[model samples]
Target: MGRAPSDSAGGDRLRFLRSFLASPRKVGAVLPTSRRTVDNTLDLAPLEEARWVVELGAGTGVYTRGILERVGSDARVVAFEVDAQLSSILASQLRDPRLSVVSDSAVNVARHLDGAAVDVIVSAVPFTSLPVPERKQILRAARDALGREGIMLVLQYSPLIERELRQTFTYVRRRLSPLNVPPAFLFACQGDPRSPAGER
Candidate 1:
């Protein structure tokens, strides 16, 4: 069988640019997540034994593939992409029984999770570019969706949201990847133990 309409590499990049132009804040970058960014982000998450992994803003499946590669065969990956076009392409390109590509706002991620506690969440969402309220909302949802021992890895071009992440997660650590387009900051967060698993 041939690759789907959204499966072409050149076409994917062109569509990514159009999506970025349509919603700069949401798309965040003109190009997809770089290898260095993805590597640094996933390194913070314990993906080897992760049974449930959630990927936010999985633009072109860069981090999605990284997570999948490191996770066990029984692992389940829930990828949230607000852009329908990009989400469609992801659904086409990543056809694994373990993956679920949801076309929805990242703030509403918990709604699609069915009360499952996530083991790791690799977020490529642009926290710096989004409005403060949306940023808080999405972070809150992610916090609630995590298990007590869950880990969240957020990748951004700036450290603007480090304080915000600290507010949600009990233990927050930051790392920098200098090889990306504009370089990037990765925040590794461990959820507060007081919250119940999958409460959101």
Candidate 2:
């Protein structure tokens, strides 16, 4: 396969704009995560003991690949791809036995694994244009899945969603990834305060 285009996420978003506009509501599948950005997010992970990695809107396995590269070989990754075509592609391409590609709604993150607490929930969903209710629900589910000591990392193109996370999580962090399309922001927050791993 040819190398994916690597253009500055600034004004020339290239593949990001094309992929993001592929669907209605001005939103599409997840934007491909850049390697540098992925490593940065992985560095933000609090617990070394985490076994479950839940990926929301894995899209084409961009961040999924990034997470896999950082986590242990036995770490379980539950990838939720809301797009059928993308899900099918991910299921076949990822060779790791630890990867489970689920073709389902991202809002059902908790239900898919029987309400189990995940160590980390990395979301690549675009929330700026979504209905407020749907946005709130997704954030709530992400918070719930953490159980205790669980964290949710959201990669967004705008600051609007960061406001939502601030109200819900114990503490919220905003990191700029200069490597991605549009130089996205990485919002990391603890779902619940009491269970924070004390790593902030």
Which parts of model 2 are misplaced by more than 4 Å? 1-19, 24-31, 46-48, 193-200
Q: Mind giving the per-residue lDDT tens digits that candidate 2 earns over 1-200?
A: 22223334442234444556677453443346677777777678853456898988777676777777667767788999776766776787676777899998778887888767788989877777777888788888878788566788888777788778887787898898887766878888884644545332
Per-residue lDDT over 87-157 for candidate 1, one digit per residue giving the tens place of the 0 to 100 score: 99899888888899999998998889889999998898998898999999999899888887888889988
Instruction: Report the backbone clash tally of model 2.
Output: 1
Off by over 4 Å in 1: 1-9, 193-200
Point to the candidate with the largest lDDT.
Answer: 1
Using TM-score, give the best candidate's number: 1
C-alpha-based local distance difference test score of model 1 = 0.85
lDDT of each candidate versus the true structure = 0.85, 0.73
Model 2's TM-score against the true structure: 0.82
> Model 1: how far is 186 from its true place, Å?
0.5
For candidate 1, the per-residue lDDT at 157 reads 88
